[model samples]
Target: MRLEFVENGPIRLEGGRFRVRVGEREEVLEKPRLSLCRCGASANKPFCDGTHKRIGFQAPGGVLEVEGD
Candidate 1:
């Protein structure tokens, strides 16, 4: 599998099968691609519902620098 973080947006995942687990619910995805939320503004929890664009979220793509790192 491959993951690409979009600039100032959701995380893009594409490739083979993968699993998504939330609480007691687990699901296996066979789709070619998926979008995951990073802005914490998605009404749909782990999935991307384009709320980041609506909320004007800002984040850097590629390598992320942690404050204490």
Candidate 2:
């Protein structure tokens, strides 16, 4: 599994087994790829609808690493 925090855009996930849960509902992602919203402007919460581009959302994007992994 790999995750990419796109430059000034959504978070991209690929080649992973994952699940999404909201309240009492849960869904196992059927697709290997997904774009999750990082900017709070997306109408589709938790998913990217390309709203960041329209709203001029800015964020530092890159891979995050933990020490002593």
In the range 3-57, model 2's lDDT, one tens digit per residue, is: 7899999998885576999789888877878899999989988899999999999
Give per-residue lDDT, candidate 2, residue 24: 91
RMSD score of candidate 2 (Å): 2.7
Overall local distance difference test of candidate 1: 0.85
lDDT of 2 at 15: 58
Q: Please give, for residues 1-69, the per-residue lDDT of candidate 1 as tens digits.
A: 567788999888876587999999999988898899999999998999999999999998863333433
Instruction: Name the weakest run of 10 consecutive residues (lDDT summed) in model 2.
Output: 60-69
TM agreement with the true structure for every prediction: 0.82, 0.80
Stretches of candidate 2 exceeding 4 Å from the true structure: 65-69
Estimate every model's Cα lDDT from 0 to 1: 0.85, 0.85
